[model samples]
Target: MAIISKLTIISILVISFALAFLAFYLISPLSKEQRKEQIGEIISQLINFVLFLWLAKILLNLQLFVQDPLAVLAYPSNSEAFYLATLFTGVLLFYKRRQKKITGVLLAHSFLQVFLAASFFYEFIQFVWRDNPFSFHYLIVFGVLLALFHLLQGRAKPQNQISIVLAVGAAGFFAINFMLPYLTLFGYIMEPWFLALLLAACFGLLIKDPQDEPHSETH
Candidate 1:
């Protein structure tokens, strides 16, 4: 009975983690139409995920399990932070119908995607190097999330600048984090090579503005 209960608890935790990630992703839409469709789905999934997380945090971490308080605090804290960003992003995107703000949205998506990649990379580095635990955990707090909250208040602005190096870095990060043999189960970023190609394409789209061109818009 004890064994069964522990397994059940762990399973629940993993599921909540996955769902929370989905909620985080749902908040990042490339277009207005996509935002409308995605917003509700994301909100719904996030509510379910947060409820599950709160349950687990109270049960496994706070009340029953009696594990290390530090572990409990750290894990659940990170989990809670998942949607905090989208709160600001969603609000601003909701109010501003201007297509110009898409840059901010795209940048947020890129940075969040980088932070997530860096997180898993930190783990990987620890596994291989055993000495260096490279971390990008707070990138959310100091980086994208903070920037987004400002955007919510109309205080945020995005300059039209995309770096080729940053683009390559994004793609490289995706390949390693999501691709590689035996790692495809995560499949979060698709294949590394594919991600490399993908980042290149995303950069191309930002500058190309296919819809702005007469011939492209006609097609």
Candidate 2:
């Protein structure tokens, strides 16, 4: 049963990844140099998420991993806003229809807008409520990185495949870090698993073949 399940999962990832890669190749406007620039911003957002957003999630779930435990019930409310904003940005892509416009907005907003809000709130809470540590830090870092992610993605300079891979890996690391904080209990990948997740997201991106038409802001 375990073997069967593993095979099923592997097959799904393979197929999905292939499609994503194809999509990227198809939609990309720039053949090579320009393409790199376009993807740079997305890569930044991916990396920022790893460093900031995921870090917050990991902290939220820290009780499961460490000694200090907080009320789990409130976590959902905290997480909900993040997920909703993420989803909203994603959905905006499809509604956009225009590849460049959609890509520009998708990469830009996802990486920046939400982060700006978080940053403001972070400072506010820190000042008002006193040192909660977890909330303030998470929001501050997440906001800054999120903005940086957008900025990086929108960079004029081109990014190489290796850099892209590293960015993705960093993004993936936080994803797994947030998802499986206590993998030690289950014999999870002890080593730096961010790279691994980046690899997987890379594969997934390739399979899905997301938009590739090297996008920049419309105006």
Candidate 3:
């Protein structure tokens, strides 16, 4: 049963990654260099998260891991691991962007759009396979936001528009989660931290100069 559960989770993650990749490929309008940089940063973050998860598991079961290093792989992740990974990834991304002299607002705008599209695809799949109404609700919301994003992409500066959309969408998502406690992923309660982060990013983007050219070409 444990092995089966592990394999199921792995399969789901694989499918999600594939869907996210396809979504990013289709929706992004960045130059090759910008795309490459964003993709590399994303992949690095994922790797860092996995490493953090492993470290967390090992620390939690030090004796067991010491006896058998492979045991760490079998350990289930807890909220601690996720929180740590989120913090680590956030700081790492900020540091790397600063080091590279990358504009924070531009990076946030691009990533938020990609994230919304990828999240929509992932939820759509879950809605189809699990028949979850919550997933369907989120899918609709994300789809609408994505449509709005694309519509405004060519006409307006994306930093402000995307930030506003993300802030609004995050508020809506929070409301839905509050009203529907049963909306969960894999029996784990979804945290509102993602929404908080989105709001923070939105505020950050809002303060940036609107006249500055974004890192990527929108058209």
Candidate 4:
């Protein structure tokens, strides 16, 4: 039963991702060919990120891994592992952007849109269907974030828009965790340091010169 439940949750997450991808296709301003190319790149990056996340999880549980690699692989990743994986993936993306392999602006904008959509769908589906505990506050946060992004469309530059969304998300999560220390993000408690790191990265992007935005990157 536990295995079945975990499988169901994973299946639901995939559905949420699919719904987010559909939202991206319907709302993105890029041409079909450009969107296709961008999707390919995004999927590649996502795969890389997931790989890093899995590796981080294993590294976090090295003893368990040494004893039974399969058991370690099946364990759920903790918050520390999530943050560490995010740090590594962020660095990788930064390096790739510096090499001009990907446009920072487009990636940030498209990712924020997709992330917001996915968060909403995932939380809503879990709350509605899952027997496990759900955070109503978490659902509201993502719903509001998605609505805010939609409302700010065209009114703000793509870079500024992403920055704002990140800031709001960081603030929202901070508030949630502070007010309810028992609450966990998904299943892992998001520490203050992790939130601080997220804000630091968001602000780092904000300080970059607006002139550096690629010509292809547009609202």
Q: List the residue pairs that clash in candidate 3.
A: none
Sort every candidate by TM-score, greatest first: 4, 3, 2, 1
Q: Could you estimate the TM-score for every candidate?
A: 0.28, 0.29, 0.78, 0.88
lDDT tens per residue, model 2, 177-205: 57544321011223444335434433443
Q: How accurate locally, in lDDT, is each candidate?
A: 0.40, 0.41, 0.68, 0.78
Q: Count the backbone clashes (under 3 Å) in each candidate.
A: 1, 24, 0, 0
Per-residue lDDT of candidate 1, residues 1-219 (tens digit): 765755554564455345444544454433445444434444454465556555555554565346566555545333223333333344444444245534433443334433344334434433344442222322222234324333442222222323433443464455445433322212121345544554554455445343332110110
Best model per lDDT: 4
Question: Model 2, poorest ten-residue lDDT window?
Answer: 181-190
Candidate 3's C-alpha runs over 4 A off are: 59-72, 182-188, 205-213
Greater-lDDT candidate between 1 and 3:
3
Q: Tens digits of per-residue lDDT for model 4 on 1-219?
A: 888978887798789888998888878777776677777877788788779889999889989899999998988777778888888888998898788787778777778788789878888887887744456778899998999898888788878788888889888887887667555555567777777877788668545555546444334
Could you tell me which 10 consecutive residues in candidate 3 have the lowest summed lDDT? 181-190
117-217, model 3: which lDDT tens digit per residue?
A: 66676777778876767777777778888887888776777666776687668766776777776434333455787547636855764565444457565
Displacement of the residue 44 alpha carbon in candidate 3, Å? 2.1
After TM-score superposition, the amount by which residue 40's alpha carbon in candidate 4 deviates from its true location, in angstroms, is: 2.0
TM-score of candidate 3 against the unseen true structure: 0.78
Cα deviation of 161 in candidate 3 (Å)?
Answer: 2.6
Point out the higher-scoring one by lDDT: 1 or 4. 4
